[model samples]
Target: MSVKNLLHSSKHSSKHSSKHSSKHSEDILVGVGLRHPHFTDILTSAKEIDFVEVHSENFFGQGGAALSVLQQVRETYPVSLHSTSMGLGSFADIPAHYLARLKRLTQTIDPFLMSEHACFTWGHLQGQLMHSGDLLPIAHTHNNLKRMCEQVDRVQTYLGRELIIENVSAYVQFDESYLSEAEFLTALCQQTGAKILLDINNIAVNSLNFEGGDIEKSVVDYINVLPIDSVAQIHLAGCSDVPHGQLVVDDHACPVSDDVWQGYRQALTRFGAVPTLVEWDSDLPAWSTLIGEAQKARDIANAVLGVNARASVMEINHE
Candidate 1:
């Protein structure tokens, strides 16, 4: 069998399929990010996905259609909360109101897991709210890691659940760094007891943009460095081709590339099957199309894990 065919077959094969079957099908849930454009379509389809994930900052409002739809969706499928604006690794203090809102949503939605980027999304040097509009990187120095650990502790404490930290797509390299991104994230999970929400696309983006190294090798290296068990879930997103450059930008504007699908399958091989998400943030597709794309993630997870078409753990356990 071809490598790609082997990956697909091993993922969705039966009990007699492969040697690795320790992780259950329930652990291989599929989900998509909640965006304004896809809200109605997601709400419309009742049998579409295993769960849904939303950006914490987007639902920071008191009352709106977004919250209402979220409330309705939670009744049907599990929801995973992902935040881009928390800035947990930043030097700035945590936003009081944002935390409260996130806390409230967690209570209301009862999400299975909540995650945020390892990079700080907020920055205020001297009292002004200087929004970076991007997931800003933190100094990897020991002192910086200490500061970041405290912030992560605070967020998990407030939320009363383990917060999974995702590695961001970094565009620039740092000079005063102490640990590699892998080491720093592994340490964060070790010290703070928070799990990791590994984004395969971000690793690829960072690898191309900054490292200028082999993408597949980079993925394997990062996975090898991380504690395999802490990989609670995985994220796959589309990226854009950089202007006049070979590296692709981590823009969630395109479809999941074949490179990323290969990475996902590799992740399943290394980490075993976990809840994987398809994140398409911009130029949203139709609801059915988005769900179809999400199914691709599910298919990859199922194929790698050696489950059947039903792919439902509840069904697997019953048998």
Candidate 2:
């Protein structure tokens, strides 16, 4: 069916738009990144998975096989739309065409949740629009924070739902950054009502790369500083293991590491079973293996939060 027809049918369906729910139990909520390589596996054999997440941009096409498959997936599981291209911190305006397409996709899918990074991507160069095509870190100054708040307010108002913004790992801290990252995030939440998608792996990677003290302590400290109620979701991902003083990247390319798992537990202790995702995008694993990682997240969260015997699954894929 065409995108318009599909959306028309969905809009008048039994379930409402802008907020989709799962047929599965939410008590043990967990999900995995739904990648094309494992589409059939997810539909056929994946059980205990509360929902599935996808890069919102992937299904933005008006009418195509991808969109059709996504519509099919929507039938079985709740879909979370994770968009990397929103560039919420950019100096230039968010492109009108991009926002309109995203709006349409949200209407079609009615994702249970939607998210983007705390970084910037597109800005004006001379007179034309240019995109860096990267989730580059944003400076943590109050001036920048004001701009980000405005951009976030604009996006949320345009989409008609609250947007979840994530904290990105940075190799270098801007010298002009007078405000702390947590402070800026808190301000954004306070001003725009947008929640945070806290990635524990990013916090760990940033601490390892720049925070220069105890790794676990610094990671946990950053989490503790953020407003507990501001976190709407959590992300658990693997990072490359590096020697002391070596650079660490949020590669999301392998099994989630020990440090990240530890931070994940700490997050649950604070955030209380916030819906989490397992992100392993680069070194994609078999569907079962990826699901195993998600199960691990469920198990750890269950143990930490005193949730018992509830079936849960975690997933991998970010960006």
Q: Say which candidate scores most in TM-score.
A: 2
C-alpha lDDT of residue 9 in model 1: 21
Best by lDDT: 2
TM-scores of all predicted structures: 0.86, 0.86
Alpha-carbon local distance difference test for all models: 0.76, 0.77
lDDT of 1 by residue, 117-172 (tens): 88876776587866678888877778877888899887776666777789888767
Error of 2 at 15 (Å): 13
Candidate 2 local lDDT, 1-319, one digit each (tens): 0112112223322232211122122344688988888878876894768778899988889999888888998898888899999899898888999999999999899887789999999987798898877788989988898889888877877777777789999877789988778888888887887788899888888887888736678766677777766787788888767787689877888898888888887766665657889887887999988889989998887686664212211210010
Residue 316 lDDT in candidate 1:
26
Point out where model 1 deviates above 4 Å. 1-22, 25-27, 244-247, 307-319
Off by over 4 Å in 2: 1-26, 243-245, 307-319
